[model samples]
Target: MPASAAKSTIALIGVPLELGAGAAGTVMGPAALRTAGLRAAIAGLGHHVVDEGDMDVPHAVPEFAPGELANCRNLSDVAAWTGEIHDRALSLLASGALPIFMGGDHSIAMGTISAVSRFCAEAGRRLVVLWLDAHADFNTPATSPSGNMHGMSVAFLCGEPSLTPVLGERAFPALAAGDIHLFGVRSVDAEERRTLVERGVDCVDMRMIDEFGMSALLRGILDGLDPETTHLHVSFDVDFLDPELAPGTGTTVPGGATYREAHLVMEMLHDSGLVRSLDIVELNPFLDDRGKSARVAVDLVGSLFGRSIVHRPSPRA
Candidate 1:
Protein backbone atom coordinates (compact mmCIF):
# COMPACT_ATOMS: atom_id res chain seq x y z
CA MET A 1 0.00 0.00 0.00
CA PRO A 2 1.11 3.59 -0.65
CA ALA A 3 1.71 6.01 2.15
CA SER A 4 -1.12 8.33 3.20
CA ALA A 5 -0.95 12.07 2.58
CA ALA A 6 -0.35 14.27 5.62
CA LYS A 7 -3.09 16.62 4.57
CA SER A 8 -6.57 15.58 5.71
CA THR A 9 -8.81 18.09 3.92
CA ILE A 10 -10.21 17.08 0.53
CA ALA A 11 -11.71 20.08 -1.18
CA LEU A 12 -14.18 19.48 -3.98
CA ILE A 13 -14.41 22.30 -6.53
CA GLY A 14 -16.96 21.79 -9.26
CA VAL A 15 -16.35 23.45 -12.61
CA PRO A 16 -19.78 23.15 -14.18
CA LEU A 17 -18.88 25.14 -17.27
CA GLU A 18 -19.75 23.18 -20.39
CA LEU A 19 -19.10 25.60 -23.22
CA GLY A 20 -15.63 24.07 -23.45
CA ALA A 21 -17.22 20.84 -24.62
CA GLY A 22 -18.99 20.26 -27.92
CA ALA A 23 -21.97 18.87 -25.93
CA ALA A 24 -24.43 20.43 -23.47
CA GLY A 25 -25.19 17.92 -20.69
CA THR A 26 -21.74 18.01 -19.09
CA VAL A 27 -22.83 21.25 -17.38
CA MET A 28 -24.72 19.00 -14.97
CA GLY A 29 -21.74 16.72 -14.20
CA PRO A 30 -20.99 18.13 -10.75
CA ALA A 31 -24.57 17.81 -9.61
CA ALA A 32 -24.70 14.27 -10.88
CA LEU A 33 -21.53 13.37 -8.98
CA ARG A 34 -22.87 14.86 -5.76
CA THR A 35 -26.15 13.05 -6.29
CA ALA A 36 -24.23 9.80 -6.65
CA GLY A 37 -22.71 10.25 -3.18
CA LEU A 38 -19.16 11.41 -3.98
CA ARG A 39 -18.80 13.52 -0.84
CA ALA A 40 -20.13 10.77 1.37
CA ALA A 41 -17.82 8.22 -0.20
CA ILE A 42 -14.77 10.39 0.37
CA ALA A 43 -15.75 11.19 3.94
CA GLY A 44 -16.06 7.48 4.53
CA LEU A 45 -12.31 7.20 3.89
CA GLY A 46 -11.65 9.29 7.05
CA HIS A 47 -10.93 12.47 5.13
CA HIS A 48 -12.66 15.81 5.65
CA VAL A 49 -14.53 16.24 2.39
CA VAL A 50 -15.54 19.84 1.82
CA ASP A 51 -17.89 20.63 -1.02
CA GLU A 52 -17.05 24.12 -2.28
CA GLY A 53 -19.90 23.80 -4.76
CA ASP A 54 -19.83 24.51 -8.48
CA MET A 55 -18.00 27.57 -9.81
CA ASP A 56 -20.21 30.18 -11.43
CA VAL A 57 -19.09 31.47 -14.81
CA PRO A 58 -18.54 35.22 -14.54
CA HIS A 59 -21.34 37.22 -16.10
CA ALA A 60 -19.04 40.19 -16.43
CA VAL A 61 -16.27 39.50 -18.92
CA PRO A 62 -12.68 40.39 -18.17
CA GLU A 63 -11.01 43.24 -20.02
CA PHE A 64 -8.68 40.89 -21.88
CA ALA A 65 -10.33 39.99 -25.15
CA PRO A 66 -10.61 36.32 -26.06
CA GLY A 67 -8.14 35.03 -28.61
CA GLU A 68 -9.46 34.77 -32.16
CA LEU A 69 -8.63 31.12 -32.62
CA ALA A 70 -10.43 30.11 -35.81
CA ASN A 71 -11.27 26.49 -35.17
CA CYS A 72 -11.87 26.78 -31.42
CA ARG A 73 -15.55 27.35 -30.64
CA ASN A 74 -16.81 29.25 -27.57
CA LEU A 75 -13.42 30.80 -27.03
CA SER A 76 -14.77 33.59 -24.86
CA ASP A 77 -16.85 31.42 -22.57
CA VAL A 78 -14.01 28.90 -22.16
CA ALA A 79 -11.63 31.72 -21.33
CA ALA A 80 -13.99 33.03 -18.67
CA TRP A 81 -14.30 29.63 -17.00
CA THR A 82 -10.56 29.16 -17.19
CA GLY A 83 -9.84 32.36 -15.29
CA GLU A 84 -12.50 31.71 -12.66
CA ILE A 85 -11.38 28.14 -12.04
CA HIS A 86 -7.72 29.19 -11.83
CA ASP A 87 -8.48 31.63 -9.01
CA ARG A 88 -10.59 29.11 -7.13
CA ALA A 89 -7.98 26.37 -7.52
CA LEU A 90 -5.21 28.57 -6.13
CA SER A 91 -7.37 29.53 -3.16
CA LEU A 92 -8.13 25.89 -2.39
CA LEU A 93 -4.46 24.97 -2.50
CA ALA A 94 -3.56 27.88 -0.23
CA SER A 95 -5.99 26.52 2.33
CA GLY A 96 -3.84 23.34 2.43
CA ALA A 97 -6.56 21.20 0.95
CA LEU A 98 -6.10 18.51 -1.67
CA PRO A 99 -8.44 19.76 -4.37
CA ILE A 100 -10.59 17.47 -6.48
CA PHE A 101 -11.56 19.52 -9.54
CA MET A 102 -14.91 18.21 -10.67
CA GLY A 103 -15.17 19.08 -14.33
CA GLY A 104 -17.89 19.96 -16.82
CA ASP A 105 -15.60 18.89 -19.64
CA HIS A 106 -11.98 18.05 -20.36
CA SER A 107 -11.31 21.67 -21.39
CA ILE A 108 -11.64 22.76 -17.75
CA ALA A 109 -8.18 21.17 -17.35
CA MET A 110 -6.71 24.33 -18.85
CA GLY A 111 -7.65 26.11 -15.61
CA THR A 112 -7.06 23.37 -13.04
CA ILE A 113 -3.64 22.47 -14.40
CA SER A 114 -2.67 26.13 -14.80
CA ALA A 115 -3.47 26.86 -11.17
CA VAL A 116 -1.64 23.77 -9.90
CA SER A 117 1.36 24.63 -12.02
CA ARG A 118 1.48 28.11 -10.53
CA PHE A 119 1.04 26.80 -7.00
CA CYS A 120 3.79 24.22 -7.43
CA ALA A 121 6.11 26.82 -8.93
CA GLU A 122 5.60 29.12 -5.95
CA ALA A 123 6.26 26.23 -3.56
CA GLY A 124 9.39 25.27 -5.48
CA ARG A 125 7.97 21.84 -6.29
CA ARG A 126 7.60 20.02 -9.59
CA LEU A 127 4.13 19.44 -11.11
CA VAL A 128 3.48 16.28 -13.10
CA VAL A 129 0.16 15.79 -14.90
CA LEU A 130 -1.28 12.32 -15.46
CA TRP A 131 -3.72 12.57 -18.37
CA LEU A 132 -5.96 9.51 -18.34
CA ASP A 133 -8.12 9.78 -21.42
CA ALA A 134 -9.12 8.08 -24.66
CA HIS A 135 -7.87 10.84 -26.96
CA ALA A 136 -4.54 12.64 -26.78
CA ASP A 137 -6.35 16.03 -26.45
CA PHE A 138 -3.22 17.66 -27.84
CA ASN A 139 -4.72 19.46 -30.81
CA THR A 140 -4.15 23.14 -31.50
CA PRO A 141 -6.79 25.28 -33.19
CA ALA A 142 -4.89 24.90 -36.45
CA THR A 143 -4.66 21.10 -36.14
CA SER A 144 -8.03 20.28 -34.58
CA PRO A 145 -10.54 18.59 -36.85
CA SER A 146 -13.36 19.60 -34.52
CA GLY A 147 -13.80 23.08 -33.07
CA ASN A 148 -14.24 21.74 -29.52
CA MET A 149 -11.94 23.41 -26.99
CA HIS A 150 -11.81 20.18 -24.96
CA GLY A 151 -9.79 18.60 -27.75
CA MET A 152 -7.21 21.35 -27.45
CA SER A 153 -6.71 21.40 -23.66
CA VAL A 154 -3.40 19.51 -23.60
CA ALA A 155 -2.01 21.70 -26.36
CA PHE A 156 -3.09 24.91 -24.62
CA LEU A 157 -1.51 23.90 -21.31
CA CYS A 158 1.76 23.19 -23.04
CA GLY A 159 1.95 26.84 -24.26
CA GLU A 160 0.11 26.50 -27.54
CA PRO A 161 -0.27 29.98 -29.03
CA SER A 162 -3.88 29.48 -30.08
CA LEU A 163 -5.27 29.85 -26.54
CA THR A 164 -2.46 31.74 -24.82
CA PRO A 165 -4.73 34.51 -23.54
CA VAL A 166 -7.23 32.14 -21.95
CA LEU A 167 -5.81 32.84 -18.48
CA GLY A 168 -6.42 36.59 -18.86
CA GLU A 169 -4.45 38.90 -16.51
CA ARG A 170 -3.28 36.02 -14.33
CA ALA A 171 0.08 34.47 -15.09
CA PHE A 172 0.00 30.87 -16.31
CA PRO A 173 3.00 28.64 -15.62
CA ALA A 174 2.82 26.58 -18.76
CA LEU A 175 3.50 22.93 -17.99
CA ALA A 176 6.51 21.28 -19.61
CA ALA A 177 5.32 18.98 -22.35
CA GLY A 178 7.60 16.16 -21.20
CA ASP A 179 6.11 16.30 -17.70
CA ILE A 180 2.65 15.42 -18.99
CA HIS A 181 2.04 11.64 -19.25
CA LEU A 182 -0.83 10.17 -21.24
CA PHE A 183 -2.34 6.85 -20.11
CA GLY A 184 -5.03 4.53 -21.51
CA VAL A 185 -5.14 6.44 -24.76
CA ARG A 186 -6.63 4.51 -27.69
CA SER A 187 -7.71 7.33 -29.98
CA VAL A 188 -5.69 10.19 -31.43
CA ASP A 189 -6.01 12.56 -34.33
CA ALA A 190 -3.32 12.31 -37.04
CA GLU A 191 -1.97 15.76 -36.24
CA GLU A 192 -2.29 15.24 -32.49
CA ARG A 193 -0.23 12.04 -32.75
CA ARG A 194 2.45 13.99 -34.57
CA THR A 195 2.44 16.63 -31.85
CA LEU A 196 2.80 13.98 -29.12
CA VAL A 197 5.81 12.49 -30.87
CA GLU A 198 7.35 15.88 -31.49
CA ARG A 199 6.86 16.81 -27.84
CA GLY A 200 8.36 13.44 -26.75
CA VAL A 201 5.50 12.77 -24.32
CA ASP A 202 5.41 9.43 -22.49
CA CYS A 203 2.18 7.85 -23.65
CA VAL A 204 1.22 4.40 -22.30
CA ASP A 205 -1.40 3.52 -24.89
CA MET A 206 -3.89 0.62 -24.97
CA ARG A 207 -1.59 -1.44 -27.09
CA MET A 208 1.15 -1.17 -24.48
CA ILE A 209 -1.31 -1.87 -21.68
CA ASP A 210 -2.46 -5.00 -23.53
CA GLU A 211 1.12 -6.14 -23.91
CA PHE A 212 2.51 -5.34 -20.43
CA GLY A 213 -0.64 -4.85 -18.30
CA MET A 214 -1.91 -1.61 -16.68
CA SER A 215 -0.12 -2.33 -13.41
CA ALA A 216 3.33 -2.60 -15.02
CA LEU A 217 2.85 0.44 -17.28
CA LEU A 218 1.47 2.52 -14.42
CA ARG A 219 4.14 1.26 -12.01
CA GLY A 220 6.77 2.62 -14.38
CA ILE A 221 5.15 6.04 -14.02
CA LEU A 222 4.88 5.76 -10.25
CA ASP A 223 8.44 4.51 -9.80
CA GLY A 224 9.96 7.58 -11.44
CA LEU A 225 8.35 10.03 -9.01
CA ASP A 226 9.99 11.69 -6.03
CA PRO A 227 7.06 11.62 -3.65
CA GLU A 228 8.12 14.66 -1.65
CA THR A 229 9.04 16.95 -4.53
CA THR A 230 6.44 15.88 -7.09
CA HIS A 231 2.96 17.30 -6.79
CA LEU A 232 1.08 14.82 -8.99
CA HIS A 233 -2.17 15.87 -10.59
CA VAL A 234 -4.48 13.28 -12.16
CA SER A 235 -6.75 14.60 -14.90
CA PHE A 236 -9.24 11.77 -15.39
CA ASP A 237 -11.61 11.89 -18.33
CA VAL A 238 -14.55 9.45 -18.01
CA ASP A 239 -14.22 8.36 -21.62
CA PHE A 240 -10.95 6.72 -20.66
CA LEU A 241 -13.11 3.83 -19.55
CA ASP A 242 -14.78 1.62 -22.13
CA PRO A 243 -18.11 3.12 -23.20
CA GLU A 244 -19.96 -0.04 -22.23
CA LEU A 245 -18.98 0.61 -18.61
CA ALA A 246 -19.07 4.41 -18.57
CA PRO A 247 -21.62 5.38 -21.20
CA GLY A 248 -22.31 8.89 -19.92
CA THR A 249 -19.37 10.55 -21.63
CA GLY A 250 -19.95 12.39 -24.92
CA THR A 251 -16.73 11.21 -26.54
CA THR A 252 -16.94 7.46 -26.16
CA VAL A 253 -13.97 5.46 -27.36
CA PRO A 254 -13.96 1.70 -27.69
CA GLY A 255 -11.33 -0.66 -26.15
CA GLY A 256 -10.75 1.44 -23.04
CA ALA A 257 -9.99 0.22 -19.51
CA THR A 258 -12.31 -2.20 -17.78
CA TYR A 259 -13.89 -1.54 -14.38
CA ARG A 260 -11.37 -3.67 -12.52
CA GLU A 261 -8.49 -2.21 -14.50
CA ALA A 262 -9.53 1.33 -13.59
CA HIS A 263 -10.06 0.41 -9.95
CA LEU A 264 -6.56 -1.04 -9.74
CA VAL A 265 -5.11 2.12 -11.24
CA MET A 266 -6.83 4.25 -8.62
CA GLU A 267 -5.80 1.87 -5.89
CA MET A 268 -2.17 2.16 -6.94
CA LEU A 269 -2.46 5.94 -6.98
CA HIS A 270 -3.93 5.89 -3.49
CA ASP A 271 -0.90 3.99 -2.18
CA SER A 272 1.54 6.40 -3.87
CA GLY A 273 0.37 9.38 -1.76
CA LEU A 274 1.92 11.73 -4.32
CA VAL A 275 -1.31 13.08 -5.82
CA ARG A 276 -2.06 16.58 -4.56
CA SER A 277 -4.87 17.40 -6.97
CA LEU A 278 -7.29 15.75 -9.42
CA ASP A 279 -9.74 16.52 -12.24
CA ILE A 280 -12.72 14.24 -12.99
CA VAL A 281 -14.00 15.33 -16.37
CA GLU A 282 -16.30 14.60 -19.33
CA LEU A 283 -19.11 12.82 -17.51
CA ASN A 284 -22.46 13.56 -19.18
CA PRO A 285 -25.25 12.16 -17.02
CA PHE A 286 -27.88 12.91 -19.64
CA LEU A 287 -26.56 10.03 -21.73
CA ASP A 288 -26.29 7.58 -18.84
CA ASP A 289 -28.43 4.59 -18.02
CA ARG A 290 -30.12 5.50 -14.73
CA GLY A 291 -26.98 6.92 -13.14
CA LYS A 292 -24.86 3.85 -13.80
CA SER A 293 -21.86 5.88 -14.93
CA ALA A 294 -22.11 8.20 -11.96
CA ARG A 295 -22.06 5.26 -9.59
CA VAL A 296 -19.00 3.86 -11.33
CA ALA A 297 -17.24 7.22 -11.04
CA VAL A 298 -18.05 7.32 -7.34
CA ASP A 299 -16.67 3.80 -6.95
CA LEU A 300 -13.49 4.79 -8.72
CA VAL A 301 -13.09 7.75 -6.39
CA GLY A 302 -13.55 5.37 -3.49
CA SER A 303 -10.63 3.28 -4.72
CA LEU A 304 -8.51 6.37 -5.23
CA PHE A 305 -8.77 7.23 -1.54
CA GLY A 306 -7.77 3.77 -0.29
CA ARG A 307 -10.85 1.62 -0.56
CA SER A 308 -9.69 -1.91 -1.27
CA ILE A 309 -11.76 -4.77 -2.58
CA VAL A 310 -10.61 -7.28 0.03
CA HIS A 311 -11.31 -5.05 3.01
CA ARG A 312 -14.23 -3.04 1.64
CA PRO A 313 -17.05 -2.16 3.99
CA SER A 314 -20.65 -3.01 3.32
CA PRO A 315 -23.20 -0.40 2.28
CA ARG A 316 -26.27 0.43 4.40
CA ALA A 317 -29.33 -1.63 3.59
Candidate 2:
Protein backbone atom coordinates (compact mmCIF):
# COMPACT_ATOMS: atom_id res chain seq x y z
CA MET A 1 0.00 0.00 0.00
CA PRO A 2 1.16 3.55 -0.76
CA ALA A 3 1.79 5.98 2.07
CA SER A 4 -0.82 8.64 2.77
CA ALA A 5 -0.34 11.95 0.95
CA ALA A 6 -1.16 14.59 3.55
CA LYS A 7 -0.35 18.23 3.98
CA SER A 8 2.37 18.81 6.60
CA THR A 9 3.18 21.73 8.82
CA ILE A 10 6.80 22.59 8.00
CA ALA A 11 8.87 24.80 10.26
CA LEU A 12 11.64 26.60 8.41
CA ILE A 13 14.54 27.48 10.70
CA GLY A 14 17.26 29.63 9.23
CA VAL A 15 20.82 29.38 10.52
CA PRO A 16 23.17 31.96 9.04
CA LEU A 17 26.50 30.87 10.51
CA GLU A 18 29.34 30.58 7.96
CA LEU A 19 32.20 30.16 10.42
CA GLY A 20 32.42 26.44 9.72
CA ALA A 21 33.05 26.71 5.98
CA GLY A 22 36.27 27.58 4.15
CA ALA A 23 35.05 30.99 3.05
CA ALA A 24 32.84 33.93 3.82
CA GLY A 25 29.40 34.67 2.21
CA THR A 26 27.65 31.39 3.01
CA VAL A 27 26.14 33.33 5.89
CA MET A 28 23.88 34.84 3.27
CA GLY A 29 22.40 31.47 2.24
CA PRO A 30 19.24 31.57 4.33
CA ALA A 31 18.31 34.96 2.97
CA ALA A 32 18.95 33.84 -0.59
CA LEU A 33 16.66 30.83 -0.16
CA ARG A 34 13.94 32.98 1.29
CA THR A 35 14.35 35.55 -1.45
CA ALA A 36 14.07 32.80 -4.04
CA GLY A 37 10.59 32.12 -2.70
CA LEU A 38 11.21 28.87 -0.77
CA ARG A 39 8.18 29.51 1.45
CA ALA A 40 5.72 29.99 -1.40
CA ALA A 41 7.06 26.97 -3.28
CA ILE A 42 6.35 24.64 -0.36
CA ALA A 43 2.98 26.27 0.31
CA GLY A 44 2.13 25.66 -3.35
CA LEU A 45 2.41 21.94 -2.63
CA GLY A 46 -0.47 22.30 -0.14
CA HIS A 47 1.81 22.29 2.94
CA HIS A 48 1.61 24.80 5.76
CA VAL A 49 4.95 26.65 5.92
CA VAL A 50 6.06 28.63 8.94
CA ASP A 51 8.99 30.99 8.60
CA GLU A 52 10.75 30.96 11.97
CA GLY A 53 13.02 33.76 10.77
CA ASP A 54 16.78 33.53 11.30
CA MET A 55 18.69 32.42 14.39
CA ASP A 56 21.95 33.83 15.64
CA VAL A 57 24.82 32.26 17.51
CA PRO A 58 25.56 33.56 20.98
CA HIS A 59 26.75 37.17 20.88
CA ALA A 60 30.06 36.27 22.40
CA VAL A 61 31.27 33.12 20.75
CA PRO A 62 33.95 31.56 22.89
CA GLU A 63 37.52 31.97 21.73
CA PHE A 64 39.35 28.67 21.44
CA ALA A 65 42.86 29.32 22.63
CA PRO A 66 45.78 28.27 20.47
CA GLY A 67 46.44 24.51 20.42
CA GLU A 68 42.95 23.71 21.66
CA LEU A 69 42.34 21.48 18.63
CA ALA A 70 44.92 21.41 15.87
CA ASN A 71 43.83 21.77 12.21
CA CYS A 72 40.35 23.03 13.10
CA ARG A 73 39.33 26.68 12.64
CA ASN A 74 36.59 28.74 14.32
CA LEU A 75 35.98 26.04 16.91
CA SER A 76 34.22 28.34 19.36
CA ASP A 77 31.88 30.02 16.89
CA VAL A 78 30.95 26.74 15.24
CA ALA A 79 30.30 25.10 18.60
CA ALA A 80 28.07 27.92 19.79
CA TRP A 81 26.07 27.89 16.58
CA THR A 82 25.68 24.12 16.64
CA GLY A 83 24.48 24.13 20.24
CA GLU A 84 21.91 26.83 19.54
CA ILE A 85 20.70 24.99 16.44
CA HIS A 86 20.36 21.76 18.41
CA ASP A 87 18.24 23.39 21.12
CA ARG A 88 15.94 25.17 18.69
CA ALA A 89 15.63 22.09 16.50
CA LEU A 90 14.45 20.09 19.48
CA SER A 91 11.87 22.73 20.30
CA LEU A 92 10.51 22.68 16.72
CA LEU A 93 10.19 18.89 16.81
CA ALA A 94 8.38 19.01 20.12
CA SER A 95 5.95 21.44 18.52
CA GLY A 96 4.97 18.70 16.04
CA ALA A 97 6.37 20.48 12.98
CA LEU A 98 8.69 18.91 10.45
CA PRO A 99 11.80 21.07 10.27
CA ILE A 100 13.49 22.40 7.14
CA PHE A 101 16.82 23.71 8.45
CA MET A 102 18.15 26.31 6.01
CA GLY A 103 21.86 26.35 6.59
CA GLY A 104 24.84 28.66 6.39
CA ASP A 105 26.99 25.64 5.60
CA HIS A 106 27.06 21.88 5.85
CA SER A 107 28.65 22.07 9.30
CA ILE A 108 25.25 22.96 10.80
CA ALA A 109 24.12 19.39 10.14
CA MET A 110 26.01 18.18 13.19
CA GLY A 111 23.57 19.99 15.46
CA THR A 112 20.51 19.55 13.28
CA ILE A 113 20.98 15.80 12.89
CA SER A 114 21.80 15.42 16.57
CA ALA A 115 18.56 17.11 17.54
CA VAL A 116 16.62 14.94 15.10
CA SER A 117 18.33 11.81 16.38
CA ARG A 118 17.29 12.65 19.90
CA PHE A 119 13.71 13.26 18.81
CA CYS A 120 13.60 9.94 16.98
CA ALA A 121 15.00 8.17 20.04
CA GLU A 122 12.32 9.56 22.30
CA ALA A 123 9.60 8.83 19.74
CA GLY A 124 10.77 5.23 19.24
CA ARG A 125 11.49 5.81 15.55
CA ARG A 126 14.52 4.66 13.60
CA LEU A 127 16.70 7.52 12.39
CA VAL A 128 18.11 7.42 8.86
CA VAL A 129 20.21 10.01 7.02
CA LEU A 130 20.39 10.68 3.30
CA TRP A 131 23.48 12.78 2.56
CA LEU A 132 23.27 14.36 -0.89
CA ASP A 133 26.53 16.10 -1.59
CA ALA A 134 29.43 16.18 -4.00
CA HIS A 135 31.89 15.36 -1.25
CA ALA A 136 31.72 12.51 1.22
CA ASP A 137 32.32 14.93 4.18
CA PHE A 138 33.76 12.12 6.30
CA ASN A 139 37.00 13.91 7.13
CA THR A 140 38.02 14.11 10.76
CA PRO A 141 40.05 17.09 11.94
CA ALA A 142 43.23 15.08 11.64
CA THR A 143 42.42 13.88 8.14
CA SER A 144 41.14 17.14 6.64
CA PRO A 145 43.58 18.93 4.35
CA SER A 146 41.69 22.15 4.94
CA GLY A 147 40.79 23.12 8.52
CA ASN A 148 37.20 23.94 7.59
CA MET A 149 34.80 22.43 10.12
CA HIS A 150 32.12 21.83 7.47
CA GLY A 151 34.11 18.89 6.11
CA MET A 152 34.04 17.22 9.49
CA SER A 153 30.29 17.24 10.16
CA VAL A 154 29.67 13.69 8.95
CA ALA A 155 32.43 12.36 11.15
CA PHE A 156 31.15 14.24 14.20
CA LEU A 157 27.58 12.98 13.66
CA CYS A 158 28.83 9.41 13.17
CA GLY A 159 30.67 9.42 16.53
CA GLU A 160 34.23 10.05 15.34
CA PRO A 161 36.70 11.43 17.84
CA SER A 162 38.24 14.92 18.46
CA LEU A 163 35.27 17.14 17.57
CA THR A 164 32.73 16.28 20.27
CA PRO A 165 32.82 19.85 21.58
CA VAL A 166 30.76 20.95 18.57
CA LEU A 167 27.69 19.55 20.31
CA GLY A 168 28.36 21.62 23.42
CA GLU A 169 26.31 20.36 26.44
CA ARG A 170 24.01 18.27 24.27
CA ALA A 171 24.54 14.50 24.34
CA PHE A 172 22.54 13.32 21.36
CA PRO A 173 23.18 9.77 20.29
CA ALA A 174 25.36 9.41 17.20
CA LEU A 175 23.78 7.87 14.12
CA ALA A 176 25.05 4.44 13.19
CA ALA A 177 27.15 4.14 10.02
CA GLY A 178 24.73 1.83 8.26
CA ASP A 179 21.90 4.26 8.83
CA ILE A 180 23.70 6.91 6.69
CA HIS A 181 23.47 6.78 2.90
CA LEU A 182 25.75 9.04 0.89
CA PHE A 183 24.46 9.77 -2.61
CA GLY A 184 25.73 11.89 -5.50
CA VAL A 185 29.27 11.95 -4.12
CA ARG A 186 32.01 12.65 -6.67
CA SER A 187 34.69 14.26 -4.54
CA VAL A 188 36.28 12.64 -1.46
CA ASP A 189 39.60 12.86 0.32
CA ALA A 190 41.72 9.73 0.42
CA GLU A 191 41.47 9.22 4.18
CA GLU A 192 37.79 10.20 4.14
CA ARG A 193 37.07 7.39 1.71
CA ARG A 194 38.93 4.95 3.95
CA THR A 195 36.94 6.05 6.98
CA LEU A 196 33.63 5.58 5.13
CA VAL A 197 34.63 2.06 4.03
CA GLU A 198 35.79 1.13 7.53
CA ARG A 199 32.56 2.37 9.10
CA GLY A 200 30.45 0.40 6.59
CA VAL A 201 28.64 3.51 5.47
CA ASP A 202 26.62 3.08 2.28
CA CYS A 203 27.83 5.30 -0.57
CA VAL A 204 26.36 5.57 -4.05
CA ASP A 205 28.83 7.73 -5.88
CA MET A 206 28.18 9.48 -9.20
CA ARG A 207 29.99 6.71 -11.04
CA MET A 208 27.58 4.25 -9.49
CA ILE A 209 24.70 6.50 -10.34
CA ASP A 210 25.86 6.48 -13.95
CA GLU A 211 26.04 2.70 -13.94
CA PHE A 212 22.84 1.93 -12.04
CA GLY A 213 20.93 5.14 -12.74
CA MET A 214 19.41 7.38 -10.04
CA SER A 215 15.98 5.77 -10.16
CA ALA A 216 17.25 2.24 -9.50
CA LEU A 217 19.79 3.35 -6.88
CA LEU A 218 17.44 5.66 -5.03
CA ARG A 219 14.58 3.17 -5.09
CA GLY A 220 16.82 0.46 -3.69
CA ILE A 221 17.71 2.65 -0.75
CA LEU A 222 14.14 3.86 -0.14
CA ASP A 223 12.74 0.35 -0.49
CA GLY A 224 14.44 -0.64 2.73
CA LEU A 225 12.89 2.19 4.71
CA ASP A 226 9.84 1.38 6.87
CA PRO A 227 7.72 4.50 6.51
CA GLU A 228 5.87 3.82 9.76
CA THR A 229 9.00 3.48 11.86
CA THR A 230 11.71 5.41 10.07
CA HIS A 231 12.47 9.11 10.33
CA LEU A 232 14.52 10.11 7.29
CA HIS A 233 16.53 13.32 7.28
CA VAL A 234 17.87 14.62 3.96
CA SER A 235 21.07 16.66 4.19
CA PHE A 236 21.26 18.38 0.81
CA ASP A 237 24.32 20.37 -0.18
CA VAL A 238 24.00 22.62 -3.22
CA ASP A 239 27.32 21.30 -4.50
CA PHE A 240 25.54 18.04 -5.20
CA LEU A 241 24.36 19.69 -8.38
CA ASP A 242 26.68 20.45 -11.26
CA PRO A 243 28.36 23.82 -10.98
CA GLU A 244 26.78 24.88 -14.23
CA LEU A 245 23.41 24.39 -12.55
CA ALA A 246 24.30 25.52 -9.02
CA PRO A 247 27.49 27.54 -8.82
CA GLY A 248 26.69 29.20 -5.53
CA THR A 249 28.63 26.80 -3.34
CA GLY A 250 32.16 27.31 -2.03
CA THR A 251 33.03 23.73 -2.86
CA THR A 252 31.90 23.12 -6.40
CA VAL A 253 32.71 19.78 -7.95
CA PRO A 254 32.27 18.86 -11.60
CA GLY A 255 29.91 16.15 -12.87
CA GLY A 256 27.17 16.09 -10.25
CA ALA A 257 23.55 14.97 -10.30
CA THR A 258 21.60 16.41 -13.21
CA TYR A 259 18.53 18.58 -12.67
CA ARG A 260 16.11 15.81 -13.58
CA GLU A 261 17.93 13.26 -11.47
CA ALA A 262 17.75 15.46 -8.38
CA HIS A 263 14.03 16.07 -8.79
CA LEU A 264 13.43 12.37 -9.30
CA VAL A 265 15.20 11.59 -6.05
CA MET A 266 12.99 14.11 -4.23
CA GLU A 267 9.78 12.84 -5.84
CA MET A 268 10.58 9.23 -4.96
CA LEU A 269 11.35 10.16 -1.39
CA HIS A 270 8.07 12.01 -1.18
CA ASP A 271 6.24 8.94 -2.41
CA SER A 272 7.90 6.84 0.29
CA GLY A 273 6.72 9.34 2.93
CA LEU A 274 9.66 8.70 5.27
CA VAL A 275 11.27 12.14 5.19
CA ARG A 276 10.83 13.89 8.54
CA SER A 277 13.40 16.71 8.36
CA LEU A 278 15.72 18.42 5.87
CA ASP A 279 18.88 20.54 5.78
CA ILE A 280 19.52 22.65 2.69
CA VAL A 281 23.15 23.65 2.97
CA GLU A 282 26.25 25.10 1.27
CA LEU A 283 24.45 27.79 -0.70
CA ASN A 284 26.78 30.79 -1.07
CA PRO A 285 24.74 33.47 -2.74
CA PHE A 286 27.81 35.67 -2.85
CA LEU A 287 28.98 33.46 -5.71
CA ASP A 288 25.62 32.93 -7.38
CA ASP A 289 24.28 34.31 -10.68
CA ARG A 290 21.13 36.19 -9.82
CA GLY A 291 19.77 33.66 -7.32
CA LYS A 292 19.75 30.86 -9.89
CA SER A 293 20.93 28.27 -7.37
CA ALA A 294 18.42 29.41 -4.79
CA ARG A 295 15.53 29.09 -7.23
CA VAL A 296 16.68 25.59 -8.16
CA ALA A 297 16.75 24.61 -4.51
CA VAL A 298 13.22 25.88 -3.88
CA ASP A 299 11.99 23.95 -6.92
CA LEU A 300 13.54 20.77 -5.58
CA VAL A 301 11.93 21.35 -2.19
CA GLY A 302 8.59 21.71 -3.94
CA SER A 303 9.04 18.27 -5.46
CA LEU A 304 9.96 16.80 -2.09
CA PHE A 305 6.74 18.16 -0.61
CA GLY A 306 4.62 16.60 -3.39
CA ARG A 307 4.60 18.88 -6.46
CA SER A 308 3.91 17.19 -9.77
CA ILE A 309 4.27 18.43 -13.31
CA VAL A 310 1.17 16.48 -14.33
CA HIS A 311 -1.02 18.59 -12.02
CA ARG A 312 -0.04 21.91 -13.55
CA PRO A 313 -2.89 24.12 -14.79
CA SER A 314 -2.87 25.73 -18.22
CA PRO A 315 -1.05 29.03 -18.42
CA ARG A 316 -3.16 32.16 -18.96
CA ALA A 317 -2.63 33.98 -22.25
Most accurate candidate by TM-score: 2
Over 1-317, each residue of candidate 2 has an lDDT whose tens digit, in order, gives 22214688899989998988997988999999999999999988788999999996677575565653668888888888888888999999899898999988999998899999999999999999999999999898789999898999989999886777667668988989889999999999999989898999999999999998999998888786777788899999999999999999999999998899999888877878788899999999999999999999999999888897775321210
TM-scores for all candidates? Answer: 0.94, 0.95
Deviation of model 2 at 298, angstroms: 0.6
Q: 167-233 in candidate 1: lDDT tens per residue? A: 7778878889768889999999999998899988788899999999999988888876877788899
Q: Could you tell me how far off, in angstroms, the CA of residue 137 lies in candidate 2 after the best superposition?
A: 0.7
Q: Which TM-score value belongs to model 1? A: 0.94
The residue-level lDDT of candidate 1 at 226 comes to: 76
Off by over 4 Å in 1: 1-7, 62-68, 311-317
Clashing pairs in 1: 2-271
What are the per-model numbers of colliding residue pairs?
1, 0
